[model samples]
Target chain A: MSAERQERIEARIAQLNAEMQKREDYQAIIRLQRAYGFYIDKGYWREASDLFTEDATYEQGVDGVFIGRERIHQVIVKLSGGNPGPGLPFGQLYERFQLQPVITVSDDGQSAFGRWHELAMLGQYGEHAEWGEGVYENRYRKEGGVWKISALHYFPNFVAPYEGGWAVLKPVEGDWRSPELADFPPDAPPTVNYKPFPDQFTVPFHYPHPVTGKAVA
Target chain B: MSEHLLDALEAHLDSIELRIARQASHEAIERLQRSYCYFIDKGLWTAASDLFADDATGEWGQSGVYRGKERIRSYLALRGPEGLGQGELNTHITCQAIITVADDNMSAKARWRSDNMHCTDGTGSWSEGTYENIYVNDGGVWKIASMHYYVTLICDYDKGWIAGDIPMDPPSETLPPDAPPTEVYESLPGAYLPAYHYPNPVTGEQPKKPDLPELPESGEDTLADAVAALSTRVERLEDQRACEKLQRSYGFYVDKAMWNDVSDLFVDDSTLEIGGRGVFLGKKRVLEYMGIGLGPTGPQREQVINHQQFQGIVTVAEDGKTARGRWRAFVIGGSSWAPVNWGDCLYENHYKKVDGVWVMDKLHAPFTMYTLYTDGWHKATTPNTRPESFPPPPDLAPTVVYLTYPNYYCEPFHYPNPVTGKEAPPPNPAAGGVANMADFASEES
Candidate 1:
């Protein structure tokens, strides 16, 4: 083969390797997000919190951010009613359906951003049934070949009584965050000011339209 | 020196290409599984069944095992004759697909999360589930070999899963399936763990026995041979990605009622079939059909249309000229003067690469059900009826006649039993496992 041809081949090889690496990075990040969901669904708070980086930040709705892994762990433990002590009771359930994900990994392959719709059904001992919907705009980092949550933000669309549905109910307000649960307060308020259903607002998109390539402004 | 350099370059290129091909295979398989959800949601039995291999096996919801492509078709068809009737809604949205391509690149396994919302007869229900599916690369075209869904929670909209008003195992009054239930499990309130297709993604722990086959050898080859192989592999990956983007673009266009753009995604001879409304053959006719249903182009000021497509499973033919995809759509739509409506459908659609661009060759959607938002599926399940002003009506009558919800029907299957590769035995009336709405109603009363 000619020298020029060999050089061209080398360049193409480099490009292909880069693309492959990007894809693997995407897979790792998605797995990290899903692992977090599975752990939280079963009240495995410690396992869920472990999915984050040491200095990661967590925020939901109006609640301020909880910085650092320990604080994040504390928040989850409080939410799960004081850890429920390893292995949930037979009748307890917290089913969170993380659906409709649009994930974008950074060009450098070191970090990624994702937006997901969350549909949750939760209660203890089959009582106090509640239905909830929300959006998660989260950031993930690749640390030593593994992905972990760098910043987790959840915006509530609605948390309503199961019997009446969103239409007949008022939106649940305030963050679940408390000083008793975590040392750090929320990092900041929600990115946008918008009301839940019965009122309509499009959750800002992180991606352009798949077909038109038009940005959601 | 030049010869040595060439050899090194070829080796590097070959390895890169192999990696790209494996990544592409993972993506294509994930899309293929997602497409199956879309097809099954619409009740497009024929289209959905086609996604399976000739010897595929499937177990969905309460339906027992269905083996073979023909059986799969028959099972899905039972959901509705031609497709869902008007006013019924069936939406099966799937996400969180963790796909693993075998080292050989000839087989794969995937795990997915399925969230289903149904409406029929003025009543609505919600369910959450998981799927562990297998795929085979048959002569370069991937096909589903086995699919099993485990329902985690299924309950009425009003009562919810926590209420305990609904039974864990409602009897199925539909025709007996080809085989008995693979395993007995109950939805929420009764704890049951569905088997996982893979170990923990992060922990790398193998909880269940690994069913993956042995990895194929990386076969010895010359530098020239490797270069040639890598070239072909890269092209295939590019084609797969292009096809995925094309289908996703179609969904976005339809969501905003971008009629011209949607029509442009089809070839001149393409066809569009929505539920029992029948087929709109050719691009001109398809455009006309869209106008009738969606109003005159652009975004209609008074209309609110949200049609979301999820779980796209796409398989490009070995020839690379044509492809088949299964998808699920969750639709919520209404106009200023009309009541809001929500529903779901399954899409078993075809695509062809025309002039280097992928476009829809045939779009077929068979809806499971659609109902008004206020009344839900339980209270006001209305049958689909033909629109009065639409011209060039349905080319054929519905394939089957059935009611949605409060009634039991098994959508036909497209593949045979996964293990047997043989037709399932017909249900025997004397066997006595069939459960119907009446049975549940009486129990609830």
Candidate 2:
């Protein structure tokens, strides 16, 4: 091959490597998020919180944002009734289905953004059963070659009795943000003031519409 | 540069190219699996069957295993007629696809979850299941080789699984399936654990078999060979990303009723089929079909059309000019005057690159079920046989009669038994003999 051709080939290889890295980065970040779901479902609070970066931020419903891995761990443990161990007792269960994901990896491959729908069914064996729906807009950072949650913001759309459904009962608000568990207050209130079902609100999109290239507000 | 340095450079380039090709394969396989849901949702049996290899085998629910492309085609056709009928709704929304590609790039396995909602004949139900599917690269085109779906739960919409009133099994009233249940598993209210296709991605140990393929030896590879290989790898990756974006764009456009924009996403000779509305051939007819749903003017102020696409698995052809995709759509739509409705659907669509831009070649959506939100799927189960008044009337009739939940019916599979490679066995005389009522009681106790 000519010298010029060889140089061109070298440049092309560099580009290919970069593209491959980006794709792998996206996959890693998604798997990381999924792993978090698995851990949380079983109330493995420490393991779930460990998936986050040291400086990660965690927020849910109206709960004030909790900064750093420690704070996240604290909040999760408290929510699990202080027993953040793996596997719930015989009568207790918490199953969460993390569905409907739209993930976008940044061009540089250092970070990524994702949107997901959460459908959770949780309760004790003989006690009341609860059904919940929420949306998560999260960010992940590639730290030391491993993906970690940099920020996790969950917006609760509805949490209601499994019997009456979201239609009849009002979802309890501001309970997720228990001040006692937080290291400090959240940076701000809910990003969007949207009530639960019957009343509808479109969550803001972080990326442009796939085809139109128009922002989805 | 020294000859030694040149050789080193050439070797590095080859490695990069190999990595790119491997990554591209992963993306393609994921999309191909997702596209299956999209096709089956709208009763596009032919389109759905086309995704499988000629020798593929499949088993879904209690449906007997089907072997070969022709058998798969015939089986799929049994779900419904050529088009969806009035008031019928079938939605199969798949998620959590754990795909593991083989080192040889010839075969792979994936596990997915399907959350389903069905409404027909004045009744509705909710069902959840899992899929352990395998894929193969045949002539550079990836196709499903074996697909097995194990339904985990089937419940009445109104009662919900928590109520514990609804029976897990539908009355054994339907005709015997091609085979008996592969494993006697009961839905929720029963204790059944369908087997996993692969070991856990984390914590669980990897299986010993199916070792990764060996890397290519760089010693004899020339600089020219490296360049050619890298070029192809780069192109495949680009094609994979573009196809995914194209499929996602379709969902966004239709959600807001961007009729013209949605129509433009298709090729001039492309076709569109929604539910049982029949096939709309060509760009003009496709746009007209959209008009029938959204009014010629586009989305009206009172309309709320949210069609969320999820669990996309796309496969770009090795040639890089054509691709196939599978997706699941969760639809919620209504207007001020109309009653609110919600449903789910599956899409097995195809695309081709035209002038370097990916466009829809064929779009098929077969719904699992659609129902009135007020009455819930349980009480208002409505068959989507043929709408009383629908625009661009279907040019075709449904292929068969199959009701959604509370009434058991299995959609045909595209592949056969994964392990035996044999066609699903015929229903045993004792099959469905005694409803496994014990399985249901096991959960409560």
Candidate 3:
């Protein structure tokens, strides 16, 4: 073959391999988030936390930022039930669905960001049922050919009783920090504070307009 | 052929083969994960545990960790004997898998979501969670290497999450694990984000805006140029896509009450049967059924009748001429003036390929449940639509008489369990059954 033709073939091969790797990475990332949701649903706190990096940052609602994989793990457990439990007490129901993901991988394929919505059905038997909705702008890193969450920032829109639903929710009064993390304060304060619902707030898009390919203002 | 040409062709073949192998790995892993869920659904602990590798480790929420395949089997069986006894409901509806297979196709990792409906000893609970698992291809069979289920929530069926958050059982004292609780946490009311094991699935880039003429007209100078360009277009049309498109098109047309377009999807001998409305055979009768029974053509003011189709399981036959599908429609119908309602309907429809086009043959929909929007299903439910409930009559009597909500009715399965290959057993009555809500229980009686 001509030298130029050989060069073209080699370039084509490299391109094909790169595309294949990226596709695999995308699928793996989505599965990782979904797996996280499943674990949260069943109160498998430790297993769920294992998916994060050693120095990951965890932030939910206005709970601020909890650093290190261990502290975040403890923070999650504290917020979920308070005690050292791998499961929820009987009668409690937690169904947090991970839906409508908009993920953006970087050029080098080593790091990426994701935007996902969470629809939660949380309640206790015969007492009160609450519905939760939130959006997550999360970051992930590839470690040793496997992906792990590097930073997780969730903006909880509302946690309203299921009776009248979010319609009955009143605007936030004072600090909206979670009570579970009150005693064990986060390593740092929340990056941004905003009230949920009634008082509208867009959690800010992390990607450009899909069709127009323009920055999302 | 020149040696260089042969080399190029060989390289292309090698890449194609590798891609195909990776695709196969994906399929195998997905099936393995789903099969594991199916076995657990029926309390088949042994079957579920066997899907794991001989040296696999198992861990449930706060259960600590069980080492070895034997210990994992014991850990799972802690739920009690297999094939759950009467009045027990252990349903784990797991879906939405994001799987990644190794380049060598030896080991794989996956993330899965599982929705649970568990009822034991007359009490029901709803819970859901995620699974981050490792799988190994052992002797040409994929087995779970490490199974981790992170609990999201488990709430009481009656009270809900806010009021009825349940805690997981602490590490079992009776049957201890090799390791103490690895991670402990509360679910909602308590908040925790499961660390995602995979990175972001997309790119962060926008193409530069094209620098072109501000306004451009049709570049074609003659009609022949435009016609010839149209003929050059290519479409990705296959059997499955064609069938799905045809069925989905029916739903879009029905949403607007477009009787003509909806009827056009069917052929001369096509049949329609919804709920207890009986059969309306032939294309002409199908139009009558929609036009008269479902109102005039096109949407009306202040009315909403959206028959949104979702979760279709389409199966094409070997002959490439006929296909069958099972689909579900979540309907949102009513008017601003009239009362609003929510409904769920199940479909078992048939299609045929005629003259290189797919057409609807038989559309049989059974209304599973319907309720008033204000009251919800727990408080208010509408029964099946009877033959005499509406204006226009049907061509034949209703097929398969069945009850709706307030009275439990298990719809027959179109396909068996994917792993077991056996049809699911009929559903048992929950708690008191029909007698509790019988006519005598009401005030009028």
Q: Which tens-of-lDDT digit does each residue in B181-226 have in candidate 3? A: 6677665434343454543221112212223222223466432232
The candidates' DockQ values read: 0.05, 0.03, 0.01
The count of residue-pair clashes in candidate 2 stands at: 62
Distance from true location, Cα of B323 in model 3, Å: 22
Q: Whole-model Cα lDDT per candidate?
A: 0.60, 0.59, 0.65
Q: Rank the candidates by lDDT, best first.
A: 3, 1, 2
Of the two candidates 2 and 3, the one with more favorable lDDT, higher being better, is 3
Name the better of 1 and 2 by DockQ.
1
DockQ order, best first, reads 1, 2, 3
Model 1 bad stretches (over 4 Å): A1-4, A171-187, B1-92, B96-156, B159-445
| Alpha-carbon runs more than 4 Å astray in model 2 | A84-90, A171-188, B1-93, B96-113, B116-155, B160-445
What is the C-alpha lDDT profile of model 3 across A80-113, one tens digit per residue? 7543333444334555666546566788999988
**CA shift of B179, model 3, Å:** 68
TM-scores for candidates 1 onward, in order = 0.42, 0.44, 0.42
Per model, state how many residue pairs clash. 71, 62, 61
In angstroms, how far off is B49's CA in candidate 2? 23
